[model samples]
Target: MTTSVSEKVYRRGPFPVKFRCLEVLRVTPITPHVVRITLGGEDIQGFHSEGADDHVKVLFPEAGKQRPVIPTMGPTGPVLQPGEKKPDSRDYTPRRFDPVAGELDLDFVLHGSGPASSWAAQAKPGDMLGVGGPRGSLFVSNDFDWYLLAGDETAIPAIARRLEELPEGARAIVFIEVADASEEQKFSTRANMTLKWLHRDGAEAGSTDLLNQSIRTLDFPPGDYFAWVSGESLAMRPIRDYLLNERGTNKSWVRVTGYWKRGHADHVHDSKN
Candidate 1:
């Protein structure tokens, strides 16, 4: 008997959504403004995150509470318990996940007084936090000749994960904007990478066009490549337009995400490609 073969598929999941209450195992400062909180417990045994940019809705406890109110899994999806006040939650990239060790790492940008930042700032060992639903993962194929990554601090976690996951000899060009030299981070990757760090130097986070300007000056290398651009919502628009309209990049090969929007709390936007 002969079997038919199918083309390789790059995307997976819409996995069952489940909430886990895990304990903070450690907290490390990656940079002056970025914190890495490692969470682990038996509850994380089967936690799944297959994409470099997979995100979990990090649930935070209400004031004076020790643990957040996690939603009960419903027939169709998660449903909040009746009459319970909703918990504060924010979407965060799962920077790393080690299933064997049952550990998950989440990097938080300590900017402003938002719930996630505030929670991460003071998080200590043994503290409990909740995480839910990476819903799905988009696994980009590594067949591209090169890769382009550009964003602000909020995008670092996802970008770093992608870099680390690239096989040796892969080529990647990275542009990251941070507060200053003090906010820059170093990564260990086998891929051939050229990185540029842009400093705001006391300027506002979303007020500059540093990412767009730097990209404009780039002399892109020859070959098909995947491009990932993310950061402030308004800042992402022009960059997306340039890549899609001016450069004539394949729409399906480019992803533009607004990790946050100025003046809007808990805002997350994924621009339509």
Candidate 2:
């Protein structure tokens, strides 16, 4: 359950293991291009997922194998057969993780034709999957005076989730870019969030200049502020550079990440692009 604003949420109380195996408990569609998959078992009792944008590494089943191989605490991390391959992996924000209920929620943008996207699109209840996390959370607490949240469609779930988590009377500006206006989402946030939708009706998923062009014009507030931006490689770079070079935001206050690149087939783990 979400804690009320009147109560202080404890961060150091407990956090899930750095990594652990999780099974698929259920999967449900939130939108035409987004699916929410909850994964866990008795193993999730200790998991503490604090906020939106916290990622978990999902291990997929290897081809021809019934399931993904669970790693043993070995000398060199993990070891598999010489020719065996690890399942395609992706990074996703933890929408929620209920420790008492032993369940964890992950939201996936089911647009890419990639393995991870396709898997979530076709996933069903009882289907087995693997998860490892509560790895770490990107901190953009409401303690700040203001915030600037921007991203493409792939970042929608996390952005929307964070907005809803903001305390009442807090302030943040949100800019969401999508393929078209029809892809817009209805969101609920306690904070005073002003959202601007940037649409590139026919342009490729992450190639548009909409987000950069708009952010360039906005005058940022001087008080303590945070900016969280995520999306394709080409798009993420411009935003990160602008925040770093122009606004002089410390790397800690500005978390810009490239979730996936347009032409790259594999997901980027530590994207500096």
User: Top lDDT: which candidate number?
Assistant: 1
- For candidate 1, what is the TM-score? 0.94
Query: Which tens-of-lDDT digit does each residue in 72-173 have in candidate 2?
Result: 434545555666666676677777767777888787787756777877777776666666665455445578888889998778868888898899998989
State the local distance difference test value for candidate 1.
0.88
Error in Å for residue 88 of model 1: 0.7
**Residue 267, candidate 2: alpha-carbon lDDT:** 69
Full-model lDDT for every candidate: 0.88, 0.73
- Deviating ranges (above 4 Å) for candidate 2: 1-19, 63-66, 73-75, 81-84, 269-273
lDDT of 2: 0.73
